[model samples]
Target: MRSTSLLVLVGSGLLLLAGCAPATGDASAGTGEAAAAAALAEGEASAAAPSPEPTAGDAEQWCADADVSARVDAALASDTEGPHNGVLVSPEEMAELGEPEAAIADQRRAWEALTDDEVAFQQCLRVRQGQSPVDPVPGSGS
Candidate 1:
Protein backbone atom coordinates (compact mmCIF):
# COMPACT_ATOMS: atom_id res chain seq x y z
CA MET A 1 0.00 0.00 0.00
CA ARG A 2 2.88 2.42 0.84
CA SER A 3 4.56 1.68 -2.56
CA THR A 4 1.28 2.25 -4.35
CA SER A 5 0.86 5.64 -2.65
CA LEU A 6 4.43 6.65 -3.58
CA LEU A 7 3.91 5.54 -7.17
CA VAL A 8 0.69 7.53 -7.40
CA LEU A 9 2.40 10.64 -5.96
CA VAL A 10 5.33 10.34 -8.39
CA GLY A 11 2.99 9.78 -11.33
CA SER A 12 0.89 12.78 -10.30
CA GLY A 13 4.02 14.95 -10.05
CA LEU A 14 5.16 13.78 -13.48
CA LEU A 15 1.76 14.53 -14.94
CA LEU A 16 1.82 18.02 -13.40
CA LEU A 17 5.30 18.60 -14.84
CA ALA A 18 4.19 17.45 -18.26
CA GLY A 19 1.15 19.69 -18.12
CA CYS A 20 3.40 22.67 -17.27
CA ALA A 21 5.78 21.98 -20.19
CA PRO A 22 5.88 24.40 -23.11
CA ALA A 23 3.84 23.29 -26.13
CA THR A 24 5.59 22.07 -29.27
CA GLY A 25 4.72 24.53 -32.04
CA ASP A 26 6.27 26.72 -34.70
CA ALA A 27 7.72 29.73 -32.87
CA SER A 28 7.32 31.80 -36.06
CA ALA A 29 3.61 30.95 -36.43
CA GLY A 30 2.44 34.26 -34.96
CA THR A 31 5.56 36.28 -35.75
CA GLY A 32 4.00 37.86 -38.85
CA GLU A 33 0.89 38.94 -36.92
CA ALA A 34 2.98 40.39 -34.10
CA ALA A 35 5.22 42.22 -36.57
CA ALA A 36 2.20 43.66 -38.36
CA ALA A 37 0.69 44.80 -35.05
CA ALA A 38 3.99 46.39 -34.02
CA ALA A 39 4.27 48.20 -37.36
CA LEU A 40 0.74 49.55 -37.01
CA ALA A 41 1.47 50.79 -33.50
CA GLU A 42 4.63 52.49 -34.67
CA GLY A 43 2.79 54.19 -37.51
CA GLU A 44 0.09 55.42 -35.14
CA ALA A 45 2.69 56.77 -32.75
CA SER A 46 4.54 58.59 -35.54
CA ALA A 47 1.30 60.12 -36.81
CA ALA A 48 0.44 61.46 -33.35
CA ALA A 49 3.35 63.82 -32.98
CA PRO A 50 2.82 66.60 -30.45
CA SER A 51 1.94 70.13 -31.49
CA PRO A 52 4.78 72.61 -31.73
CA GLU A 53 5.75 74.50 -28.60
CA PRO A 54 4.30 77.97 -28.14
CA THR A 55 6.97 80.55 -28.77
CA ALA A 56 7.56 83.62 -26.58
CA GLY A 57 6.21 85.66 -29.46
CA ASP A 58 3.09 83.55 -29.42
CA ALA A 59 2.73 84.15 -25.68
CA GLU A 60 3.14 87.88 -26.17
CA GLN A 61 0.54 87.86 -28.91
CA TRP A 62 -1.86 85.91 -26.72
CA CYS A 63 -1.38 88.28 -23.80
CA ALA A 64 -1.91 91.25 -26.06
CA ASP A 65 -4.99 89.83 -27.75
CA ALA A 66 -6.53 88.80 -24.45
CA ASP A 67 -5.74 92.13 -22.75
CA VAL A 68 -4.68 90.01 -19.82
CA SER A 69 -3.04 92.88 -17.96
CA ALA A 70 -6.13 95.07 -18.04
CA ARG A 71 -8.38 92.19 -17.08
CA VAL A 72 -6.05 91.34 -14.23
CA ASP A 73 -6.05 94.93 -13.03
CA ALA A 74 -9.84 95.02 -13.03
CA ALA A 75 -9.98 91.77 -11.15
CA LEU A 76 -7.52 93.10 -8.61
CA ALA A 77 -9.38 96.42 -8.24
CA SER A 78 -12.51 94.46 -7.39
CA ASP A 79 -10.49 92.37 -4.92
CA THR A 80 -11.35 89.25 -6.88
CA GLU A 81 -9.15 86.53 -8.25
CA GLY A 82 -9.31 86.21 -12.00
CA PRO A 83 -9.49 82.93 -13.86
CA HIS A 84 -5.83 81.97 -13.77
CA ASN A 85 -5.17 80.31 -17.11
CA GLY A 86 -2.41 77.91 -16.10
CA VAL A 87 -2.78 77.84 -12.38
CA LEU A 88 -4.40 75.05 -10.45
CA VAL A 89 -5.05 74.24 -6.81
CA SER A 90 -2.26 72.87 -4.68
CA PRO A 91 -2.35 69.13 -3.97
CA GLU A 92 -2.82 69.80 -0.26
CA GLU A 93 -5.70 72.17 -0.90
CA MET A 94 -7.22 69.79 -3.45
CA ALA A 95 -7.10 67.01 -0.85
CA GLU A 96 -8.75 69.26 1.71
CA LEU A 97 -11.45 70.08 -0.79
CA GLY A 98 -12.08 66.34 -1.30
CA GLU A 99 -10.81 66.44 -4.86
CA PRO A 100 -9.44 63.30 -6.41
CA GLU A 101 -5.70 62.66 -6.04
CA ALA A 102 -5.54 62.11 -9.81
CA ALA A 103 -6.57 65.73 -10.37
CA ILE A 104 -3.58 66.97 -8.43
CA ALA A 105 -1.28 64.53 -10.20
CA ASP A 106 -2.56 65.53 -13.63
CA GLN A 107 -2.12 69.24 -12.95
CA ARG A 108 1.40 68.62 -11.66
CA ARG A 109 2.23 66.57 -14.72
CA ALA A 110 0.97 69.28 -17.08
CA TRP A 111 3.01 71.92 -15.33
CA GLU A 112 6.08 69.73 -15.37
CA ALA A 113 5.67 69.28 -19.12
CA LEU A 114 6.23 72.99 -19.73
CA THR A 115 9.64 73.96 -21.05
CA ASP A 116 11.79 76.41 -19.10
CA ASP A 117 11.35 79.08 -21.77
CA GLU A 118 7.62 78.53 -21.74
CA VAL A 119 7.53 78.89 -17.97
CA ALA A 120 9.58 82.09 -18.18
CA PHE A 121 7.32 83.54 -20.85
CA GLN A 122 4.25 82.60 -18.84
CA GLN A 123 5.72 84.15 -15.72
CA CYS A 124 6.44 87.33 -17.64
CA LEU A 125 2.87 87.49 -18.80
CA ARG A 126 1.54 86.72 -15.34
CA VAL A 127 3.61 89.51 -13.83
CA ARG A 128 2.29 91.92 -16.43
CA GLN A 129 -1.22 90.80 -15.61
CA GLY A 130 -0.66 91.67 -11.94
CA GLN A 131 -0.79 88.02 -10.96
CA SER A 132 2.07 86.39 -9.17
CA PRO A 133 4.35 84.23 -11.30
CA VAL A 134 4.53 80.56 -10.43
CA ASP A 135 7.60 81.12 -8.33
CA PRO A 136 10.22 78.39 -8.12
CA VAL A 137 8.34 76.80 -11.06
CA PRO A 138 6.80 73.34 -11.14
CA GLY A 139 9.08 70.25 -11.09
CA SER A 140 11.65 72.44 -9.40
CA GLY A 141 12.34 73.85 -5.94
CA SER A 142 9.19 74.57 -3.90
Candidate 2:
Protein backbone atom coordinates (compact mmCIF):
# COMPACT_ATOMS: atom_id res chain seq x y z
CA MET A 1 0.00 0.00 0.00
CA ARG A 2 2.82 2.45 0.80
CA SER A 3 4.63 1.65 -2.47
CA THR A 4 1.40 2.16 -4.52
CA SER A 5 0.78 5.57 -2.88
CA LEU A 6 4.40 6.70 -3.63
CA LEU A 7 4.08 5.59 -7.29
CA VAL A 8 0.78 7.60 -7.67
CA LEU A 9 2.37 10.72 -6.22
CA VAL A 10 5.40 10.45 -8.50
CA GLY A 11 3.22 9.91 -11.57
CA SER A 12 1.07 12.97 -10.74
CA GLY A 13 4.14 15.15 -10.25
CA LEU A 14 5.50 14.15 -13.66
CA LEU A 15 2.12 14.91 -15.29
CA LEU A 16 2.02 18.40 -13.82
CA LEU A 17 5.60 19.17 -14.95
CA ALA A 18 4.82 17.96 -18.47
CA GLY A 19 1.73 20.21 -18.66
CA CYS A 20 3.70 23.22 -17.42
CA ALA A 21 6.63 22.80 -19.82
CA PRO A 22 7.54 25.88 -21.97
CA ALA A 23 5.73 26.11 -25.32
CA THR A 24 7.68 24.52 -28.17
CA GLY A 25 8.84 26.16 -31.47
CA ASP A 26 5.36 26.03 -33.05
CA ALA A 27 3.92 28.15 -30.26
CA SER A 28 6.10 31.14 -31.21
CA ALA A 29 5.26 30.56 -34.87
CA GLY A 30 1.53 30.79 -34.06
CA THR A 31 2.09 34.01 -32.16
CA GLY A 32 4.15 35.39 -35.04
CA GLU A 33 1.36 34.60 -37.49
CA ALA A 34 -1.13 36.39 -35.25
CA ALA A 35 1.14 39.45 -35.05
CA ALA A 36 1.54 39.47 -38.81
CA ALA A 37 -2.24 39.34 -39.25
CA ALA A 38 -2.69 42.25 -36.84
CA ALA A 39 -0.04 44.28 -38.68
CA LEU A 40 -1.78 43.66 -41.98
CA ALA A 41 -5.09 44.79 -40.53
CA GLU A 42 -3.48 47.99 -39.28
CA GLY A 43 -1.95 48.61 -42.70
CA GLU A 44 -5.30 48.19 -44.40
CA ALA A 45 -6.98 50.60 -41.99
CA SER A 46 -4.35 53.29 -42.60
CA ALA A 47 -4.66 52.83 -46.36
CA ALA A 48 -8.42 53.25 -46.20
CA ALA A 49 -8.17 56.46 -44.20
CA PRO A 50 -8.78 59.65 -46.19
CA SER A 51 -5.95 62.07 -46.84
CA PRO A 52 -6.15 65.45 -45.13
CA GLU A 53 -7.45 68.37 -47.18
CA PRO A 54 -5.23 71.32 -48.08
CA THR A 55 -4.60 74.18 -45.66
CA ALA A 56 -4.49 78.02 -46.05
CA GLY A 57 -0.98 79.41 -45.98
CA ASP A 58 -0.60 81.98 -48.73
CA ALA A 59 -3.77 84.07 -48.35
CA GLU A 60 -2.03 86.71 -50.41
CA GLN A 61 -1.30 84.33 -53.23
CA TRP A 62 -4.92 83.35 -53.80
CA CYS A 63 -7.00 86.14 -52.23
CA ALA A 64 -4.52 88.90 -52.98
CA ASP A 65 -5.11 88.67 -56.70
CA ALA A 66 -7.09 91.86 -57.41
CA ASP A 67 -9.85 90.15 -59.38
CA VAL A 68 -10.38 87.40 -56.80
CA SER A 69 -10.01 89.69 -53.78
CA ALA A 70 -12.81 91.95 -55.01
CA ARG A 71 -15.30 89.12 -55.16
CA VAL A 72 -14.19 87.61 -51.83
CA ASP A 73 -14.33 91.02 -50.13
CA ALA A 74 -17.74 91.72 -51.60
CA ALA A 75 -19.03 88.36 -50.39
CA LEU A 76 -17.57 88.98 -46.96
CA ALA A 77 -18.84 92.60 -46.82
CA SER A 78 -22.36 91.78 -48.03
CA ASP A 79 -23.11 89.78 -44.87
CA THR A 80 -21.33 92.20 -42.56
CA GLU A 81 -24.51 93.36 -40.81
CA GLY A 82 -26.43 90.09 -40.85
CA PRO A 83 -26.31 87.10 -38.50
CA HIS A 84 -23.85 85.76 -41.08
CA ASN A 85 -21.38 88.39 -40.01
CA GLY A 86 -17.84 86.99 -39.59
CA VAL A 87 -18.77 83.84 -41.49
CA LEU A 88 -17.04 82.83 -44.71
CA VAL A 89 -19.09 81.41 -47.63
CA SER A 90 -20.96 78.21 -48.41
CA PRO A 91 -19.48 75.39 -50.50
CA GLU A 92 -22.54 75.36 -52.76
CA GLU A 93 -22.49 79.11 -53.11
CA MET A 94 -18.74 78.99 -53.54
CA ALA A 95 -19.16 76.37 -56.27
CA GLU A 96 -21.82 78.51 -57.95
CA LEU A 97 -19.73 81.65 -57.60
CA GLY A 98 -16.73 79.77 -58.95
CA GLU A 99 -18.53 79.21 -62.21
CA PRO A 100 -17.51 81.69 -64.86
CA GLU A 101 -21.12 82.18 -66.06
CA ALA A 102 -22.52 82.85 -62.57
CA ALA A 103 -24.05 86.30 -61.96
CA ILE A 104 -21.51 86.89 -59.22
CA ALA A 105 -18.60 86.30 -61.57
CA ASP A 106 -16.10 88.03 -59.33
CA GLN A 107 -17.04 86.01 -56.27
CA ARG A 108 -16.79 82.78 -58.22
CA ARG A 109 -13.41 83.69 -59.62
CA ALA A 110 -12.12 84.51 -56.16
CA TRP A 111 -13.52 81.32 -54.67
CA GLU A 112 -11.98 79.27 -57.48
CA ALA A 113 -8.54 80.60 -56.64
CA LEU A 114 -8.86 80.04 -52.91
CA THR A 115 -6.67 77.51 -51.07
CA ASP A 116 -8.34 74.54 -49.38
CA ASP A 117 -7.98 76.31 -46.03
CA GLU A 118 -9.61 79.40 -47.49
CA VAL A 119 -12.32 77.21 -48.92
CA ALA A 120 -12.79 75.64 -45.47
CA PHE A 121 -12.98 79.13 -43.97
CA GLN A 122 -15.61 80.05 -46.53
CA GLN A 123 -17.52 76.91 -45.57
CA CYS A 124 -17.44 78.04 -41.92
CA LEU A 125 -18.89 81.38 -42.96
CA ARG A 126 -21.69 79.62 -44.80
CA VAL A 127 -22.42 77.68 -41.61
CA ARG A 128 -23.43 80.92 -39.94
CA GLN A 129 -26.01 81.32 -42.72
CA GLY A 130 -27.40 77.90 -41.73
CA GLN A 131 -26.05 76.38 -44.92
CA SER A 132 -23.51 74.03 -43.32
CA PRO A 133 -23.75 70.28 -43.86
CA VAL A 134 -22.33 69.69 -40.34
CA ASP A 135 -22.72 71.08 -36.83
CA PRO A 136 -22.24 74.75 -36.04
CA VAL A 137 -18.73 76.02 -35.43
CA PRO A 138 -17.10 74.67 -32.29
CA GLY A 139 -15.95 77.04 -29.55
CA SER A 140 -13.01 79.25 -30.39
CA GLY A 141 -9.64 77.87 -29.27
CA SER A 142 -8.94 81.02 -27.37
TM-score of candidate 1 relative to the true fold: 0.33
Candidate 2: tens digits of C-alpha lDDT, residues 1-142: 0100000012111100001111121111111223533343234234433223323423433344555455445544552232222333322332332322342344334446657555544443332222222122222121
Candidate 1 lDDT tens digits, 104-138? 57655655776754555455444443333444566
The models' CA-based lDDT, in order, is 0.35, 0.30
My TM-score estimates for the predictions, one after another, are 0.33, 0.24
| Candidate 2: stretches off by over 4 Å | 1-102, 133-142
lDDT of 2 at 108: 36
- Lowest summed lDDT across 10 adjacent residues in model 2 is found at 1-10
Clashes of each: 0, 5
**Each prediction's RMSD to truth:** 27.3, 30.2
On a 0 to 100 scale, what is the lDDT of residue 99 in model 1?
37
> How much does candidate 2 score in TM-score?
0.24
| Candidate with best lDDT | 1
